[model samples]
Target chain A: MLGIDDPLIWGVYILCILSMILCVVYGLINWNRGEEAEVQEIAEEEAWEEEEEKMQSEELGL
Target chain B: MDLMILNLVILVYLLATLYLGYRGWKATKDSEGYMVAGRKTHPYIMAMSYGATFISTSAIVGFGGTAAKFGMGLLWLTFLNIFVGIFIAFVIYGKATRKMGHNLNAMTFPELLGRRFESRFIQVASGLVIFLGMPLYASVVLIGAARFLETTLAINFDLALLVYSVIIAAYVIWGGLRGVMYTDAMQGTIMFLGMAVLLFETYSRLGGVTLAHQALTNMAPLVPADLAAMGHTGWTSMPVLGSPWWWTLVSTIVLGVGIGVLAMPQLVVRFMTVKSNRELNRGVLVGGIFILMMTGVAFAVGALSNVFFLNTRGMIATAVESNVDSIIPVYINATMPEWFIYVFMLTLLAAAMSTSSSQFHTQGTAIGRDIYETLTGQKGGRSILLTRIGVSTAVIMAVILGYYLPGNVIARGTAVFFGLCAAAFLPMYTLGLFWRRTTRAGASAGLIGGTLVTVFMYLFVHKAESAPLGIAKMVLGRDVLITQMPWPVVDPMLIALPISLVLTVLVSLITRPPPERHLDLCFRGMKKG
Candidate 1:
C-alpha cells in the first residue's frame, strides 16, 4: 500500500488519517451536546467571579 | 529573496501580532483573564493555541530532519500525536481538567493539583520543578528561532535574540495567555497553510505520493554503511526490529514525545481555557486537523526530501548536509520558489513564537501562582504583578541561556523536558483526576519519586543524555552507567512512568483517601455531558 513494503509503516500512515477523521466525526457529533450543562456552569462561573473579585479587593485593601 | 520584501512581510506580520496582543490586553480585567483567558475563550482559539504551542519550530525543523534520516517510521509518532495527543486528551482529560479547574477555581496546572489534594507542598513542588526545568527547553527554542532570523535576515545573533525575546515578552507580559492564544491562532493558521503547500508541492514535484515513495524505496541500497549497522532498513520501512535504532526510534522519539505531551504544563492549561466540554469537543476537530497538517506534512515531506535531493543533486538529503537538522531547510531552499520561502519563514517564526509564548506564560505562572502565592499566601493583584515580573525574568533567563548554551543542546532539550514531565506529572495527574482513592501522600510520592528516577536515568542510564551530561563518566568512569545495549538506548519515561503509576496506586492504597467532600466538589459536573 502506498508504495511501502512494510505493513507497520502503511498501517501507521492509514491510522493517522483515520484518527484525524475520528476526531472530526467526534467533534461534529458532540458539538452541541453539552449546552444545558454550560448554562449552569455559566451561573457558577459568575458566582465564582464575584467571589474572586471580592477576595482580591480584600487582599489588596481596596 | 529580496531583503526589502522580506523586511516588509515580517513587519506586517509583527504588526498584526501586536494588534492581537493589544486586543487581548484590552480584554483582560483580572488575573483569570490573564491566566486562562477568563475561561471564556472561543473553541477555535483554544484549539489552535494548543496545537500551535504543541508543534514548535524544533518539531518541524529538528524532528523533520530526524524523519529524513529515520524514514517513514516517524509517521507512528504522528498517529500517536493525533490519537493520543488530541483525541484521548480532549475527550478524556480535557473535560475532567476543565470541570475540576473550575470547581477549584484553579488558575494554573500546579494549582489544580494542589487544590485538589489540599496540598500546598504539591503545588509549590510542581511549580519549582517547572520553573527550574523549563528554562533549558525555552532557551533552545529561543536559539532555534534566533538562528533562523540571524541567517535569513542577516542580523546579528545577539540583536535577533534580544529583539525576538522582547517582542514575545511584551505581549505575554501585558496580555498574558489571552495574548499568547490570540497570536497562536494566527500563527497556527500560517503554519497549517505553509505545511499544506509544502506537502502539495513535494507530492506534485515528485510525481505524486506513491511514485515519490517508490523512488525513495528504490534508493534503499544507498543507506550509508554506518546507519545500516545501526538498523537502517530503508526509507519506507521501520528500522530492523529490536535494533538500537528501533529502540531509539520507538522508545525515545515515538513514545517519549507522543505520550509525554499529555503532561506538558503549557499544553494542559489550555484545557481550562474553554468554558465547557462542548468547546473541547469542538476543539478536537480543529486541533486534530491542525496537528495532522503540521507534523504529518513535515514528516512526509522530510522523508520524501530524499527523493527530491536524489533527483536533483544525485545524492540523499543527509549527503547534501551531514547535519540532519539542515535537511528540511535545505530542501525548502532548493525546491520551493522565492515567494514560498517568505511564507515558510513566517511559518517557522509562528511556530517558534507560539511555543515560546506558552512556555513563558507557564513559567511565569509557575513562579507567581504556584510558588510565591502558595508560600507567601498572597493572591489577587499582587500575584498578577508578580506573574508579569516572573515572565520578564523567564525571558531574560532564556535569552542568557540562548547566548551561553552550546548549539548541540537544542537537539536534546525537547525530549528531556517532555520525558521529565511525563514521568513526574502524568501518573499523579491521571490518578488525581479519576481516582477518588488518590491521597495527597500518594500524589506527592509519585511526583518526587518519578522526578528523581527520571533525573537519575538521564544522569546515568540513558546514553543520549548521560554521555553528553558526563556525570556518569566523571563519577562512574563510564559513558553510561549501564553499557548494556538496549538498556542504555531506552528512554527514561518508559522506565519511570510505570513505576510512578504503581507507586501512586500502592501508596494511595496504604494511605488515607482524600476527603469525600472535596472529592465530590472536584468531580461535580464531571460526569455530565
Candidate 2:
C-alpha cells in the first residue's frame, strides 16, 4: 500500500476540507438573506399574475 | 457465494431509482413544475443533487480505473472540480446566471440563452442539440454501471440497461428536477459514506494508510519501456518532460472537464432553482465539501488501487491492464472481502443512476420544453403534455442505445458526449451571458459549425483506436498536427471552442443589429415586469 499519510496528499486533503467548511459558512449566510430577496423579487416580477389574482378576487367579491 | 446477495442489492437499488421517479411523477405539475420543481427546491436537497449529478459513475468507474492505471495524477481533477467546478461555478456562474434568470423570468438553459439574447431560434436550437446529444451521455453512464454489474453480478447486458434506464427515468420524469434533487441528496450521502468506508477498508487492507503510498511510490519506475518510447509516463512519476502523457493529463482531462463544467447545461439550470445569490453561496460550500470527499477519496483510493494491484499481482501498474476502465471494478472485486462488495456495488449504482437520471432530464426538458413550444404555440393544446412525451421518447432512446453499445466503446462515447456539449453549448452559453451583439444567426452558426466539426473529427478523425487520418492529422498532413505542448489535447474542444467563439462574434457583428427595443426588452426585463 502507498503512504496515505504523505504530507503532500494529506496537505491537499486538509486544504479541501477547510475550503468546504468555508464554502458552507458562506452558503448559510446567503440562505438567510436570499429568502427575503426572493419574496420581494417574486412579487415584483409576478405583478401581472398578482393583478390577475386581484381581478379574480373582485369578480368573486371575496 | 454472496454474489446472489450482491445481485439482490443491485436489484433493490435499481428499484429505488424507479420508485423515486414514480413518486416524483405524482408531484410533477405543469411544465414549470415538471422542469424546475416549481422553483421551490430545498437548499440541502439542491446541493446533494448537484453533487450527485456532478460525480457520475464515469468519475467512479472510468476515472477511478484511470487512477489505478495513471497513479495519483487523476486526483487533480477532483481538486479542480471543487475549486473550479463547485466554488467558481457557484460564485462566478451561479450568481450571475441566477441574477439574470430572475431578471428575465427564465426557466431552462435554452430559455435563459434565448431570452437573454432575444433569439428564440438560438434557444430552440440549443434545446434540440441538448435533447439529441445528452442521451448518448446517459447511455454511456448506463453502459459503465452495466459493465460493472456484469463483472460483479454476472447479469446480462440487456437486463442491466433496462433496469438502469427505468429507475433513473422514473425519478427524473416524475418529480422533474425536484425528484432528482431529492434522490440526489440521499444518493450523495450514500456515495460519501461508501467512499469513506472503501478508503478506510482499502487502507486497513494495505497494512495501514501510511504504508500504502510507500508501496505505490516505491514502484513508479515500473513504467513500460514501450510506453516510455511513445512518451507514455508511468505512475511512479509525473511523466517524462515534454511527454504525451503530460499533455493528455493537462489538456484533455484537466481542461476538458475543468473549463467544460462552465458549459454543462444540467449544472447551469441548477443556478436558477435557488432563490438568490445567498442560496447559490450556500450551495457553494456544500457542493465543495461533497466534491472534495467524493473526488478526493476516489482519487486517493484509485492511486491506492495500484497498491492493491501490485500486492495482488506481481505486475507493474500499467502492465497489469491495458484498459484503465476495468481497473476500478477489477480491484473492487478482487481485493474487498466478499460481504462489503454489495456496498461498493450500491455506490457504483448510485453514481450511475444519479448521472443517468440527470442526463435523461436534461435531454427531455430540452426536447419537450424548448422544441415543442417553439415549433408549435406554447399554449396550444397539450404543449406541456407534449414535453412529457419528449421525456418518454428520450428514455426509450437511451434504452435502445444502451443495449446496442459495446461495453468497450462506452468510455470513448463519454468523451464524445462532453465534446459535443462543449462544441454545441459552451460557445453560445458564454456569448449569451456576455456578448450583447450576439445575434441568433451567430449563435446558430457557431453551434452548427462547432458541433459538426467536433462530431466529424471524432468519427472520421479521432483515432483513439487507430490512425484513421484524424482531422488534425489530415490538416497538418504529418505525424504531428497541432502541437499543444504540456497539454496532451486530443479533444477538438481546443480547436472547436476558439472557432465557435470567433464565428459567434463575427457573425453577430456582421448581421444587422436585432431590433434595439427587442434587445433592450430582454436585457432590461430583468426583475421588471
Candidate 3:
C-alpha cells in the first residue's frame, strides 16, 4: 500500500470524489434545460423542413 | 453453489434492455427516425449513449487487463478521454458536425462527408471501409465481455459470446438508433455505478488509496527482468521516457484512442441525435463524469489489484495467468463478493452490448444508406430495410470473428481500429468541418492515403501479428517489408497521420475549388459559410 502520510494521495482522492459529485449535481440541475432546448430545436427543424418543401414545390412550378 | 440469484439478476437486466429496445422500436416512425432518432434525442440520453458507445468492455475489461500489466500510467488515457473525447469532441467538433449534418440532412458520418464534398465515391468508399473494418472492433468487444462471463458463470466462452451477440443485434436491428441510444443510456448508468463500487471496494480492500498505490510503487524491483529492461519504472509511474514501454503507452494506446475518438463513425452519429447545440452542451458534463468513472476506476482498480494479490496470495500481479486479459476476471472473482460479481457481470455486458450495438448500427447504415443508396441513387423506406439487413450481416460477421480471435487480443484489436480511424479519417473529418477550401479530391486523397499508409504499415512493418497470419514471412521471407525505421516499430498512426494530413493539404491546394453553393450549404453556420 502507498504511504498514508503523503497528503497528495488524500488530495487526489478528494479531487476525484468532488469531481464526481459536481458532475452528478450539475447534470441533475441542467437535465431539464435540454428538454426545453429540444422542443425549440424541433420547432425550428419543422419550420426549416416546411420551407424546404415550399422551395422544392416552387422549383417544380407546382 | 446455487446461482439462482445471479440468473435472476441477468434475466431482469436482459428484460430491461429488451423492453427499452421495444420502446425505441415503437417510437421510431420512419427511416429518418430510425436512422438518427429523428434528430430529437434527449440530451442526457445522447450524452450517455455517446459515452457508452465510446467505451466498451474493451475499455473496461481489455484495458483494465492492460493496466494490470502497465500500471497507473494508463490513467493518461482517462485524462485524454475527458479532455479530447468529451470536451473537444462535444464542444468543438460536435457543434460543427451537428450544424453541418443538419444543413446537409446527412444521416451517417460517411454520408455527411460525402455530401460535404459532393462525392458519392467518398460516401461509398467510406461505407465499404467501415463495413470491412468495424467488425474487428465489434468482435473485440464481444470477446472481452465473453471472457468475463466465461469466468463468472463458468460457461463456455463461445456460448457466452453467441448469447451476447444475439441480444445486442435484436434491439439494434429492431429499434435502430433510438433503441441503441435508449439501451445505451441505461447501460451507461449501470457501467458508472459498477465502476464506482469497484473503485471503492478495491481501495478499501487494499487498505486505502495511499497504501494501495505505495504498495504498487514499492514493488518496482519485483518487475520481471524483461519488463525492467523495457524501462518499466513501477506500476505507479510512467515507464522510462523514450523506452519501448513509454512509446507503446503514449503513442499506441493514449494518442491512438484519444485522437481517434474524433473520427469514430458510431460516436460521431450521437452528436446528430441531439436536438440542438444546447443539448450537446448539456451532454458534456455527463459524458465527462461517465468516462471518468468508467475508465478512471477501471485503470485504478486494475493497478490496485496488484496490492490485493500481493498482500493476500504473496504473488506478483501478472502471475494471475498466462493471458493478460484474464487479469480483471481473476481479480474480480477472487476478491469481489458473489453478489457484486453478478453486478459487475451486468456492467461488462452493458459495456460490450452498448458498443457492439452502435458498431452494428453504424456499419449497417454505412452499407445501406451510404454505399448502396449512394451508388444506386436509392432513398427512403427501402434503405431502412436494407440497413436492418446490413445490421444483421454485420452481427453475423462479428460473431464469426469473435469465435476466432486469440486470447488477450482485445486491447490490441481495439487500438488497431482506433489508430486506423485517426490515421485514415481524422484529417479529412476536421478539415471538412472547418475548412471551406477542402475539396472533394483533397478529402478523398486524405481518406485513401491515410488508410493505405496505416494498412501498409500494419501489414508489413508495425507488428508481426498484424500481418495476415505469417503470410509476409512466407512470401517475403521476413516479418516486415522494411525492417529499419528510426524507431524500430513506431505506432502506425504516428507515421500515417502526418502523411495523410500532408496529402490532404497538398491535393486541396492544387485542385479546383468546389462550387460556391456547395461550400455555402456545407459551411452554412461557420465563418466560411
The candidate scoring highest on lDDT is 1
In the range B65-131, model 3's lDDT, one tens digit per residue, is: 8988888777778777777788788778988898788778776789888999999999998898899
- Report the Cα lDDT for residue B159, model 2: 79
Compared with the true structure, all predictions reach lDDT values of 0.82, 0.67, 0.78
Query: In candidate 1, what are the lDDT values of residues B310-388, reduced to their tens digit?
Result: 9989998888867665677777877777767776777687788778878987888798789989999977677777776
Which residue ranges in model 3 land beyond 4 Å of their true spot? A1-62, B15-42, B380-386, B464-468, B485-488
Please, what is the TM-score per model? 0.92, 0.81, 0.88
lDDT of candidate 3? 0.78
DockQ for each of the predicted structures, in order? Answer: 0.48, 0.25, 0.15
> Interface RMSD (Å) of model 3?
7.6
Off by over 4 Å in 1: A37-40, A47-62, B18-42, B154-163, B174-176, B380-386, B404-411
Rank the models by DockQ, top first. 1, 2, 3
Per-residue error (Å), model 3, residue B367? 1.6
Q: What is the interface RMSD of each candidate, in Å?
A: 4.1, 7.6, 7.6
Name the runs in model 2 displaced over 4 angstroms. Answer: A1-33, A38-40, A44-62, B3-42, B166-180, B207-210, B316-323, B337-339, B378-389, B403-411, B435-437, B465-489, B508-529
The total number of steric clashes, by the backbone 3 Å criterion, in model 3 comes to 6
Tell me the docking grade of candidate 3: incorrect
